[model samples]
Target: MRKFVLAAASSALLLSVSTQPVKADDDLLRLAISLCDFAKTDDRSSMRRKLKAAGMRLRAIYPAIKCGADGSLLRVATVNNAFEAAKFLASKAGDEAINAPEEDGKTLIQWTEGLVAAGDASKQQFVELYKSKM
Candidate 1:
């Protein structure tokens, strides 16, 4: 019947639309994390511009930190030694970000401490940032 055909067509259109992945923001977030490791070769200004154009909040939490667990953007930035990205998120999210804990109840400061113990003393700046906020 004509009605049945129309209904099926509409359903297929809706399914396709819904299944399309909106990946701009996700790509930006991943790039932001990667920038931390390649800071010398990366352009922080360009990254920020792209993220802003996509309407992605610098402080938005990405849920990929711990296998579906939620974590602030700051957490990811700090974990990867992305100083600029972490500082930007710290300024935006403030105390909430400074004090955010992982699923294991470990705070950002604690994570930084662990990094320091492991010979990454540069993360000390992050620990100081969170401590100042506290």
Candidate 2:
């Protein structure tokens, strides 16, 4: 009888644990998206908070750093839909261009230098954040 009860309790615990949502990383990614969206819309305070919550790091000088780059990988940017995907990712991921692997063995910074030169405000905010550590 005791053995049966122990097995039942273990099963219940396992079932409960399995049913819990497993999306810590997903949540962070979502938050990163939100931060980028907010930045595109000129919502700085909220965007900053969202980026902070996601544990993102900014290594670039500003969103303009990559704003003009081909943004094909991010469908939102491909459409020129007002969403700065690179800026958002950089703010949260800490200079994806710095280490983002690619076919030409190029960093995100090198690939997006043209865009960065265009003076992206959203990316500039990230640089500020990186500097402030906020």
Candidate 3:
């Protein structure tokens, strides 16, 4: 009975440890997506700190992840005008991702343009950044 209990406890510990990384990755992704909304309420310094931390975690998980059709984190950041977060993501994503198209075939440049049309003059920096990469 003692050996059985010990074996079961060991199995449970191993299972918990194995599952921890997946949960942490999911949390990082959630935090990355929420960064856009967080930027709205937080000061730039606070936002930058959060963005940097999230970026570090995401980089560890996905060292080569780019702004592909599925990288909704970049899309959300750009759409919400989370410039600092977007920039941090861009740094990790590389130059090719700067113009990568979404599922609808729209690039980050197009998204920034939409913001510009809506009177968001601040997005010009993003536009220029995308263009420079292209």
TM-score of each: 0.53, 0.34, 0.50
Give lDDT tens digits, candidate 1, residues 21-77. Answer: 345334433554443333323345654665566554544433222212224455556
Better of 2 and 3 by TM-score: 3
RMSD of each: 11.4, 14.1, 11.3
Model 2: lDDT of residue 112 = 44
Model 2 scores worst on lDDT over the 10 consecutive residues at 1-10
Model 2 TM-score, all chains together: 0.34
Per-candidate clashes come to: 0, 9, 0
The digit string of per-residue lDDT tens for model 3 on 5-105 reads 11243234334756685565454445444443443333345545765774444333322332333344555566567677666656656655556675567
Local distance difference test, candidate 2: 0.39
lDDT comparing candidate 3 with the true structure: 0.54
Ranking by lDDT: 3, 1, 2
Which of 2 and 3 is ahead in lDDT? 3
Clashing residue pairs, backbone N/CA/C < 3 A, model 2: 62-123, 62-124, 63-123, 63-124, 64-116, 64-120, 65-116, 68-115, 97-108
Model 2 lDDT at residue 115: 42
